[model samples]
Target: MSEKSTVPGQFTLVLHSHLPWLAHHGRWPVGEEWLYQSWAATYLPVAKVLRNLAAEGRSHLLSLGITPVLAAQLDDPHCLSGMHHWLGNWKLRADEASMAGNTALGAHEHRLATEALDDFETRWRHGSSPVWRELIDAEAIELLGGPLAHPFQPLLDERLRTYQLHEGLADAQHRVGHTPAGIWAPECGFTPGMEKNYDAAGISHFMCDGPALRGDTSLGRPVWDSDTVVFGRDLHVSYRVWSPKSGYPGQPYYRDFHHYDHASGLKPARVTGKTVAGPDKAPYDPELAAAAIERDVADFVATVRERLFSESERIGRPALVVAAFDTELFGHWWHEGPQWLDQVLRALPEAGVTVGTLADARDRGYVGERVELADSSWGSGKDWRVWAGDQVADLVDLNTDIVRLALDTLDKMRADQDGLRDPVADQLLRETILTISSDWAFMVSKDSAAGYARDRAHEHAHAVREIASAISGGQLAKAQRLAAGWAAADGLFPALDARRLGPALGGNDESGGGSLRNHAGPRGRRMDAEGPR
Candidate 1:
């Protein structure tokens, strides 16, 4: 009747783009450097690729998850100027390498740095929100928003978790001009009944790991009486290209992320081999890596087609195969990733497999039956061990105490004075959310940046405790001073107001009308730093 829709099944590619608030934290090895590196290497390049495809009339190609915290950084004027400076310095570093006789390496890096600078100055001159809005408006990609500061919602206090989820989506609406219908739950972490929270927040769908669905991730499933659907990552298809033991990026020809030339502060060597030492590794070659990308693209397309075809037959319906990954895995971690992505997206459609966003898949009837998802995450052992296990016990204890103190302080303040604009309380809440971020625990467990992570966690916790004490002691002047200082340092969410925490403190109203303040949800609009901007 309608040509029978020859598409066997739908394949959705989800890339999670996130980074902690890094501006003014530190430079060099960790803090701001991490943000700039990913911004240039991953964010910009991926945006370019998506824009190019959109120019070719590709719509709803994939789902892009951008954390609220990362969005704040992108939109901040401070970070914009800092990122511009970083690019200029990046080109200088490459020139220095060339002067030292590493011309080939320097030339490659210099070209990249130059192009990134030009792109930033041209398209990103205003802010990243406008750039992303263009893509969203074009229907070229579906955007996924997460909680403010990327807190691990399952481990958080229910009240705090709700506050974060609502505020996060609100912030995204503020920036991107449209509330996201879906979210990429931080770390794919979830607990039963969390779907109810998603429902209340106006979220239509979200994602989790395969184990959360008992390994049946062939289709998006409605959970717990909520029409809000949950999609799980299909590891069988995803791991075909990138796994711990082996991945296309780990191949000898791709640029090595770890090994860096000390003088130029740039990575110049290819991965070479698993056991190869940095000093002994071979120089990176662009031509060889380009060839590898094509081969991997072909293999990956075949893998997705086969997985979808087999699952469609077994399940007796059109299935959906979602392969999710960290957005940084492309240009940041895997130097050749963006190019490979470009190839795969183009190849899949030609290979007779449908490529579309998760929303598109659902609209085309790829949803399965309702399910009861277990408490799970996409971490080690397919459980919550990474964020809440014995390895991070101290940090876990700190998060509990910090969230409690901040909520208690805010509730007490509201009891005394209703509808007072308290910057001190607002900043305290900001510090509390930063401390509860899931990154600290994950870093500690993995030992990747344990020291920096632990320090950051404690730093925010200390700030929260100090500001709360100043408020509780009736030292309003002292509290304001302390808050002003912390706001100068860890200030990311400018639209966050202390009154937004009312619902989390046992207030009945979703809109803050019957509560201490009169702030509406992000969808309906909310108060800004200067009041209703």
Candidate 2:
């Protein structure tokens, strides 16, 4: 028998890698800075850990979902070059910090910056496609695909949603040369009957927040009599590492993410205490951190071990425990995240725990009783409030208006042109996707960079309004010019076609023969924008 058959239960870690399209949009504080910082502090180290493990003959290590938008940016010429410059600038900042008499901060940053720059120069200089593709070929990970711009599916009209799903998978296939049978549905957002959509897209499994399962998150369940399985984030096991009040990252010895040495743009302090003010936090000590990481890893391994045995006995069978988190959390938010990741993976298997991706759980017969799932997301309050709340009511309404307008206009323009794809229509679709991204509304509801989120939403909306009006008024030349201008920034997924939003794509819509424009749903209309400032 395989190790999987002998183990008590299976644990799958799902790390969602996503960021809204940030290239050529903004740089400092929110835009490309978010990308570069995460790239330096998170992506580099995390990829290194995985690569190291794969070299050690580890297969089926974990499930990683790289959003189509983020994947595009990772491989984009502009982002690749920008990331190089950012890495160099980081080294310069470290030098400046040292020259200004902060020896510890400068030395630490210099080492980190040098390593990151070397990683980029050697492996990432060409772009991240080859990096991800290498892992995919190694079979060390199960790649989960997602929508092009990470829209909340429950809020999208069937026409656009179907199109977005297809195009997003296509983009992923183009990037990594593998079309995933699974998806990390943006925000784990789900509505009833979405299985048909997944089925049509050739997806075998997808994710959801734990509450969506209501009980027994130890197995993947087929939703509503469909073969498409749904795996839920086992929050009880997941929150142990990053929970607000008691996660491992909160321990005082870990590095503080919020306390930065402004002089050199480096974080120089440890999280001396959770409630302790930033200025009073103790200086970071690597020795303390090494001790903390070892303890955390062992504790996490024990936690999973306990949960697995408890769940299997409770359910009367071997169980499946899925711990899902944002990929950025490991390094960007929790500075020692990459180290913890490497150690945890090694520890779990050594503890006689079975480790595998969600796909392994499915194939190994970790299926449970089929049940109807309810609408849910891994958002604030565990519901749609964060994206559809009263605070973002305007965004919701605007999203509805713009989605309907963009689709209808594209449809009309296609009809006039004998069903050919129009450049103007494509750009309108791109802006619409960006405008309705869940990030914007999320930032607004959380009051983190609400203004930037609002501005991006309006900017895309303005572009949509402009392109749509131009087309409607028969100003094809002006509309073409505007599309070209917008493409300079909003261009991603060049293969994106406005003509693909067909009702005939087949997703169990009663109105399959009719346009998939009936977007009337439970909450307010749908919309999105970006930022935390």
Candidate 3:
């Protein structure tokens, strides 16, 4: 522990990184652009920070939740090549900005773009698995896995939900050469008895929002009599650094995320004030931002120390404070976010506050008493409404039909001894997963890129319906053609073997804290028995 004699608890930083399947989809403003920007800005810089600390012997610095969907993009050859090109284009755009007389902003952009390009060419040219694997191998970070696509588990069919989780874990193993012991449940969404599924898949721990535990989130609790521990994110600490209304990122000094310079495609302004318009915002200065990062880092460290000490006293035991957020929040949304994160990681340990991964905190005996958590998520209202409410009822109905159709089609095919190895069946499953991604419902509810998100969901759903219809009607040619077309356009998860979906139906017990009899399915590695309660 890096804690001082006076510091009485632990702090774990958990970041959930995810993006929907964007490869070969649209580019600028929506699809691959989102992936490329996060890679160059967030992933590369954050990896460098961790690698630097790891070299200096910092262990378990944080828990990084890279959902399988994002991992697939990071390791995809097509995406890697595209990202390389994007970086080169970035540097060129910076040069263009310099030629246009915005010397200061251009020079900054040029330097950032050049360094990112150099970093990408030298190390990331091989893909990101190796970079992340280095951190994991060095024990500098614990990688958390999630479903194949980041589907809202609570709303998904139990059979498909288990399939997504198992396959997602397997995908992580295949890419990074290690199995994750924990997961960031998509949206931190969990239904009662879901822990049994986690137990069945050999997952040891997972995260939920603090409110889900009724605000008593000082320690990890065993859920539903299962040994799979669930840690709740401490919003008190998390919101101090970044939240909807208040946070360091919203400070006047940081670069404005929404105000863009359309000509050069750069953010040239600072967040002058909350009500400031894009055109009226002041110019950004690195020096101003650097000073703010220092101040913010010190403030955050003090806040964490105070919280940890108070919680330790109240709980009568060493408490654990888990602050979790979306990885994209750093760099992508707030340009100075990655720098602040680097400083925060360094400052906390120096300030006598223990900084470690969730696994480290748990292993140090931060476990709490068992509790039956209510059905909940970290979304608005701390419930499933964001994903399954009236606002997105169409998406909800579409997902329900997609799940039923796929299962019925698969069951019929298997009844005639046609197993899941068929290409049509594999592609059908892929479409189903794409349609149910939590991102769609989130986008619709927030009205941020809602049209694109809705269209994407419907497109995948239509594909599933068409493919399943072809399979059920015995139109093998039509089914294969439709599946092949989809495989060409929206294909992700190269390791997504449809056979891992298990016994399509009747597998979920649904009545108690027990999972399907066969969880790993054919062609999948069998999971170990659950830990004792």
Candidate 4:
């Protein structure tokens, strides 16, 4: 981390990279499309930036969180072949565009598609393990992990949460060759005693929203009474680049993510105006976008410099300013985001603003006093509303019902079979995990692909119900076929075992400490597993 002897403070850029399991699921409008688009647009370019900077002798560039489920897809055999085909199709589309006389769009897309294909072939064809492993080995970025499937821990059963987190950490270890001491806690959703869980799991630091600190995000705080540090995002700085109302991506020069040239499957328009119809938008110009990237990079560097100086003065010492964003927001949503990132990272060091990862900020003692964190998330209201709000009340009930039923069936079978390896129970557990994912509730609440989200949740729940029934009815052959079919579709974590979800390990009785199974509350909701316990 480069710094002036009397610098204002350390600045950390945290990018949370995550997506739900989308392997053998649908493709065109929702499932694998999301994965492949992000892989090509965001992952490839951002990784290239990090690798280039590492070659330039840069280390501790930023902190990146890749959830284990997304990691699984990035390394899955099915997804790799699918992505290869996607890239090939991208180039073919560009060729078609050229034949159709949109020469400029065709030329630009051809270059991008060819580069992406080469990068994928050379580095990513095998799997994402080597690609990320190289960066991890070089110390270019600190990798922060999260629970498998990105479950909303605050709403999960204690035993399930513990299993998910530990397994999530182990999965990352399996991929990158080291267990992460830090995590981007799913949804930033935290309960009070969850810090103790982090401590038990050996997680040293985690992140939360700015409001979790009551707006005091100048430094990382020790949560309650644990050494597990909680870093709250400096939303004032983060929102300056990408927020609900305004951000750099809204600039007229950037390529518009919404508008598409349907025939070629390429984005050919700039964000000419906020309310501009797709047909009215101007043609995207790479040169103009490059100029915008430079302008935004300068603005961001200046923002950090000003925030650091002002925060240092107010706090009476050098303070920490963390700007965290969804990694997908970069190249996927904002076409020039990778370029902007490259510039801002290099420019910050030159501007006398110290840049470092979350680990650097913590190890170098950019920490503050201990404070008790309340129920919070980086969601709509900085609370549990997004995942546990009224709009998702049905999902909450469905999750509760399936969890209890699956646990009951598994518990019965495990005791009867003396802890035998039951693939049916393993598939049962897998479906439940998939069913309870936070993405389903989030998408429904935000009205972004709500239909697909709801269908996925119900589909998994139905799987659990039918498999458990098959077992209880003594239909062993039918159960085997069902579990095998589901595993063929929802197959990501190869090491997940049904036997490992042994009791709560350590948690309140409501979440599997004892025999308190029927946890359905008013309107069939699960009351006990929520955050404020």
Candidate 5:
């Protein structure tokens, strides 16, 4: 009997692409560089992979969640232009190395640099590629939407959160030319009552980690709360491709993530093993890594085929095995991830293991009804500890205090008719929303770029406090001073409306001192627990 005859089901893949709104915010360690690097390593390459697969007449299923913030950067004329310049600069830097180094090393450096430049230019040429469009059109990809800036849903000022979510959806529709059927919920952060807001906004489904589904680490069905389906990531299958320490990319033969050449500030080494560190690392060999990709892809395909058959037989239906991961993991961290992706897509069809997107699987009746959902995330241990850990304890406190102060200020401004048109109020609202951006806490927790994280968190906090003090003390002169500074900062959520937050804070008082606990239901109740996802 054929393997297809033995296996009873299909599998789905969902990839979420999210980065905080970093344009014009911070640049060096954590801000724009993060976006640019991901764009080069993961976004552009993955888009190319999808386009290539579709061209070969392979209709594989993949769900991609591109946050509104990231979309803005991608579509921004300045970012596009800057990206082009950056790639060109990279080529120049590589050339400089080629001229300075020994013949063999110089030649290798020159070749790799040329390849990088060629790939980037070819894919991003003319400021357009139907790569994203082609996948959407072919129905091979499903788009997941999120807020304008990825603020933590439960921690945000309720009205601002609603506006961010609504506007984010609208923005995505405008940019991509389609309203998404689901949302990626920032970091898959979901609260008990957020569903009502999602429902009002016309979102039909969303995704969360497996732990969110009754604490079980398996593929789960949709939750209660208004028929909006929830698809949980199947970590078991996902971890095989990328685990904390045991992922395929960590193999000694892969390109090293750390240990760049200090003088040139370029990566020139391969991961020898867990013990290899810094200056002692061996040279990278793309050729050797390519060989590893074939082996890993074969192993991955067999795992999926086996999973599909096992799940199908167990469930007595075509069960789906969803493998989800951060888009940055590919090409950026793994280096060989894109190659592995290409091989796996081709291998699945040959093995008769049908690959499909989340939407396709749902349409094929692969959904189940579950009422209870646990509070969870895809962070360490699949929980919220990372964002709320001791390392960022001060940030958590700062966010709480600032949010409270901003809410109070907004409430005061609304209560006084004179404050309605006051530029200070408007500025306060802007600072408040920006301050609550989920990226700050995330960066602090990860320590990936902690210095920038501290600066950003403190900067927003300073704005919030200064504005609040000015408005409260009737120091119009000083408030204006602070407002000028905020304007110079130039945050993205400038048009945030404090009135939208009114209902959430207990009444229409815009001074900002209302309890969200009072507003925790459909109308106002939906406003109670807005925090970062």
Candidate 6:
């Protein structure tokens, strides 16, 4: 018998980039500081990696999901101004270190900080608003859009979910000049009926975890109830680079994430070894870490090549090995992550393995059969416990009650008024949507920044409760007063209109599902009117 010919293999690398709506929110354990840090460490560095590869005539495929909320923040004038100031401050700090430190250390610090600042200024001169446009112009990346402000979809009231999804897509298109073909599903939180809404939005595909795939994972394929394809991340391939417990980043030579210098509040240590405690970790050295990155890149390439070859031979078709990760992980968590990415993208093609985007894989006919996906997330243990854990049970209850009350209030107001002319009611509606953001509850549950998270959740909840009470008791003046106070603090999504949610709040249609359709008009009016109240 003649030996069978094996099919070629393929893989996609997807990175999801997001930060909460924090343009006005300032620096702290959780706020705009997080945004600046990720920008300096991950976004800018990742952009350089992609740009370099593209310049070299290498086609390295990667999918990047930039949430609409994040896009807004990136494009915000205030954020752009703040980022410029922040970059200049970084350089100043480096100069200070150089003046106080050993000459070699000083020189290295100043050089890196100066180079980073120069790159940030050159690449983002169009201000924060045009970063997405620049990336699209280069065609070095594929953009993945998501619901406005990253709400947990399954738990949201259907009307609000529809409004968020619809408005988010519109916002992305307005900003990026193209309707997105895929969504990141806000924390990879997917429900049974979401695909129908996705199909209505003209999205061709979305991503979920590997376990969401039917049978054994091989390639992305369409899900049932809609024609939009779902690509499942191959956890086996991804975890090799960065897992919770083990990954290349956790190696002895890599920079330690936890052992930061108390005075500077900057990480200043290397892992040294698995047994090394936080206090005892060795000081970080960029030169040593660079060497480690080289070794890890080689190892990663070997693993991908082996998996692709073996799987192709077994299946007699092209095999995909997706490696999905959070964009924050690159330089924020693992200081060497950006360098490792640069090395891996440069080396993968030489290993005879293809590097391609999710869209490319789909276009080349790599997708397989469709299946009904389960409710899933990429959180702790691949479950929703992180968002709905015991620590946040009360928060979940509070949010649920407030959302129902807001929806009921909205219904009553719409029924009572001739049109959506009530500014008081409009403010109430905006507060309601802000209160319903899944981010607050998630932060509370994770204890990542528990105090701020609890405060924000309660703040929005109080606004909703008070507004509903005032409206119900016929205290229109008091309701208006309270709306003004809350608006001053949380004035985002100002264009939110309660009228567009309509009567079918939680109802789903027989096929796919009912979504809030855009009302025809100027873009701003449509966005404001169609978004969730």
Q: Pick the candidate with the highest TM-score.
A: 4
The 0-to-1 C-alpha lDDT of every candidate, in the order given, reads 0.86, 0.86, 0.86, 0.89, 0.71, 0.73
Which digits, one per residue and each the tens of the lDDT, describe model 4 over residues 126-199? Answer: 89989899998999999999898899887787778888999999999999997998999988988788999999
Q: Give a tens-digit lDDT track for model 5, residues 1-533.
A: 38554655677778878776677776666577777777877887788788878777767457888887777667666677777776666666666666667344446656645665676677565433245666788866788888877877754556677877887877766766778888888778766667777878887778888767743323446566576777778777888998776889888788888776656556777898788676787777778888899899989888888877776677666777888888889888888888888788888877787777777776777777665665556766555556566666677667767877876676666777653566677678777666667777787777777777778778877888978888899887999888877766543444444555444445665435422232222211123236332
Ranking by TM-score: 4, 2, 3, 1, 6, 5
> On a 0 to 1 TM-score scale, where does candidate 1 land against the true structure?
0.93
Model 2: per-residue lDDT, tens digit, 1-533?
36534568799999999998889888878899999999998889999999999999998999999999999988899999999999999999999988998888789889989999999999998888889999989999999999899998887777777888999999988888999999999988887778899998999999998988885699999999788999999988899997767898889999999998877789889999878999999998888999999998988888888899899999999999999999999899999999999999988888888899989999999998897987678887667777777788788878877877776787677777877777788899899999999999999988998998998999999999999999899898999999999999988889988777673334554333222132322343222223110
Candidate 1 wrong stretches, greater than 4 Å: 1-7, 503-533
The alpha-carbon root-mean-square deviation between model 4 and the true structure, to one decimal in Å, is: 2.8
Listed in order, each prediction's TM-score against the native is 0.93, 0.94, 0.94, 0.95, 0.86, 0.87
Ranking by lDDT: 4, 2, 3, 1, 6, 5
Best of the candidates, lDDT: 4
**CA RMSD per model (angstroms):** 7.4, 4.4, 6.0, 2.8, 4.8, 7.3
Candidate 3 lDDT tens digits, 1-533: 44455798899999999888889879968989999999988998888889998999988899999998898888888999999999999998898888999989899999999989998898898888999999999999999998889988865667788899999999999989999999999999887878999999999999999998998889999998898999999999999978878998999999998998899998999999999889999999999999999999999998999999999999999899999999998989889988998899988888888888888877998999998987788888777667766678778767766777777777677677545377787888899889889999899988988988999999999999999888878899999999999999877886777777677444443422223222221211122266211
Q: Candidate 4 — worst ten consecutive residues by lDDT sum?
A: 516-525
Error of 5 at 446 (Å): 3.3
List residue ranges in candidate 4 displaced over 4 A. Answer: 1-5, 504-533
User: Which regions of candidate 3 are displaced past 4 Å?
Assistant: 1-4, 418-420, 507-533
lDDT of 1 by residue, 1-533 (tens): 23223658899999999998888888867898899999999999999999999999998889999999999898888899999999999999999999999999999999999999999999997889999999999999999998999887666777777888999999989998989999999998877779999999988889998878987999999987998899999989889877888878898889999999998889999999999999999999999889988888988988888898899998998889999999999999999999998889988888788888988877888888899876677888767678777777777668766776777778778788768777887899899889989999889989988999998999999999999888888898999899999999888888888787744433554322121122222221223346532
Model 4 scores a C-alpha lDDT of: 0.89
